[model samples]
Target: MSELDHASDPVVGASSRRDLFKLAGAGVGLAAAAALPLVPATAFAATPRFRLGEPEPAFILDPDVLYMNIGTTGSTPKYILKQFNDDNREVATNPTQSFGGVTPFRTLAAPGFGAELEEFVISYNTTDGMNKILAGVELNSGDEIITTNHEHPGGNGPMNLLLQRRGVKITRVNLPVGNNQKAQDYVDLFKAAITNKTKAFVFSAPTYLTGTMLPYKRLAKLAQKNGIMTIVDGAHATGMFNLDFQQTGIDFWGCSGHKWQCGPGGTGVLYIRNRVTKANPLPLFNFWPTNTNNSTLIEPRTNANAETYNIGTAVQSIGNPNYPMLKAFAECCTFWDSIGRGVIEKHDLTLSLYLKQKIASVWSVDNLYSPKDDPELLSALTSFSPFHTSSASVALGQAATDETAQSTTFVTRMREEYGIVIRNTAVPVIGSPAPHHPMRISTHLFHSARDVDRLVRSMKDLASRMDAGA
Candidate 1:
């Protein structure tokens, strides 16, 4: 080969994999430092081309701890965190230089979330948005709002408050558990619960309890058919699902940016269908907080378009909020967008499927808590029982509690002994008297097949060592 041809080859010419790792460690632009062409984030996307656990200079998760709990929280990328620290330092020194949340990030983030520019707001986690919307809603004594059993405190907290203060009745559908159910079952369960007294249908898409992605389109159809408003607790859906608020026709959705989006804590995205459209035109009760410019006006809120009024500002612009944190969130979303949402979803879903298979192979399919067969019911979260169960059935109540405790203990052992981080969710079985505590695992772009295998093997060994036996 000619000397010129040899010089141009990135692999053979000075820039080797070892040099690339060193460049990643350097405190500068990694691509530039390595003298390699900068590739878009989309280059690492789906189609199974890039191997898992591939070197990403941007991410800095600990190599020792196998973090399988992105469902609980995610590690921020090094670049974003560096900027966050720098911005915080700048504002700290000046003490008044930061801008409000809206203008800085509005245009850059809107398209990525499929939200109109005015509708998106960087709020404090999923619960913060839930509280704001719940307070803004109008209800009277005995008025009913529908939700499922799988809701977290963020969604349930406000509803519970209303139940105590205003006597609004919060009815819950006992969502069916296990992989035996179908998507239509969800529609039927929710449809059966709707009555003329029902004012709102609130539920989680892929609930935190079981990682079940309830059919939002079908459920929203039911809400629309009956003239009921819809509120979705989408804590785990933000970075995992390809969200299109207008198309889904859900009136509201609140999700955490930290969980799968890999943004900082206290950051999240809330989508409010601001305009009156064929999809959702129901007049909403408006309450502008004192933090926003809207607070000064005595005039009732009016709209130029669905997005004319930025209701999210009520939650976002409250008393000199974290400007640097909001900006970091915008960067995180841009990173996701450049990679392409469809590609990320596909890759995450693949890891989830692989983990589910590995778990089922050892524990048996019947032991799986999260759905396995339904394509529509998948997420990056997987849950299953990894405790000791006797061949002979144990007595119902206290025995159930004992077993669930073991499941919880098993999770602790995985972290302490195996250096694997995961979580446990206690869910109610159809006939069981007590809640079933299953180990929950979240797989993301950072995980590889080796990670999954090691995680599964570690879990298996730990279960035996702990003797999950009741």
Candidate 2:
């Protein structure tokens, strides 16, 4: 097969002897392939190239922990981790070449993502990318930016800052808290939000909190109709979904490689729509002077103000960035692509649906979240309220009882006593002064049918135990 063909093959697991032979052959040009010896007939063909279901060595996870928190941050696999380590080791051996060579860390980062060497700008994390877009954007006071109330604080806080500090106004569209919202529903809401004062329309492709997937293509087109810029906060989309920016045509995107993409913690990506970057008055790539008292003012002052804001110089010093981690991020994409996004999505939803079903049947839990078959409307995670009203009330009211608590005593009992890791969220209840709802749960690729079974069993045990004692 051609090198390009080899490039596209799914890397399932460890490298094969034949793969090694071919790799060695490529080293010597045309003559190497001719000189290579034939492989033994008994040797198994390269292990199906590390796809999902294959257990990979973990970087930071404890052997005993069942980590369902990939939604918060993912653990790096072994192969890409080796690359990150090697890169750091090389830097330690020859720090000058690694950090200040012809291709600086920022410049070296570009071609890795198949974009131009100049377009790649590295940030500390997803929030760093958000700040970059806000800092680099040129918006006048009273110009409105539309986003969602479903957004994580990472995006929401920045929008609030713009509202408070820059005099810009923000319009947050409230989404249906439960059930599958139709695609047209999103298009209509965006249409209603756009106006002459609308400068930008920013939202997540699949939001972190609610797990609602936006109609990105329609949103992109709507923004274009009103000459508004589109900024997508895709902290959950990178590895969790198949993302083709060219297909969506969004203006600006902020994604964290760590969450679903399973990259390093400090790894995140921001893409500026080529056309918007070209025409906008905001400087996309200039460097600010060290003498700046008001650095924020200088960035949005022009389009070419400082490339530094787009690409920070201090990444190497802070994280020393595991190079292998970046490669692993790419490899993780490759691995997900190998299984096919359609397949992974289907698998995740299947597991999620089964989980939801079992939770309903066994525990009588209320999945006040999403419906089955509307996979696009949700991710692997499913949030739920308890089946019993009193249980939920106690869960919600626990905070009032202890002002200085990390979480409720109920949650503490679950983790310390029950060995389960579930998330607690505060949602709105009708007629309540403060709308903090009960807890939610997250499901992911690493979870098995048995995991859901256990969850169902545990909830059943807890509910029964609570009722019997009462």
**TM-score of each predicted structure versus truth:** 0.84, 0.70
lDDT of 1 by residue, 1-470 (tens): 10111133332111222233343332232222223222333344432223234425667877778889998999887888999999999899988877554566756777877788667777789998788777766777988999988899999999999899999999999887666778889889888988878988889987898888888888888888888888898999888876767777787888888998889999888777777666655554354443354554434555434454555555465677678888888888887776666555655665566666666678776667778566677777887876632122334778976876787788887888889999988776665566777888897767765677789899888877777442
Model 1 TM-score?
0.84
Candidate 2 achieves a global lDDT of: 0.55
Tens-digit per-residue lDDT, 223-248, candidate 2: 76677777888787666655555446
Who wins the TM-score comparison?
Answer: 1
- The CA lDDT of each predicted structure is 0.72, 0.55
State how far residue 433 of model 1 sits from its true place (Å): 1.2
Q: Show where candidate 2 strays beyond 4 Å.
A: 1-51, 54-60, 97-120, 275-342, 363-366, 371-373, 387-411, 428-432, 467-470
Q: Give the TM-score of candidate 2.
A: 0.70
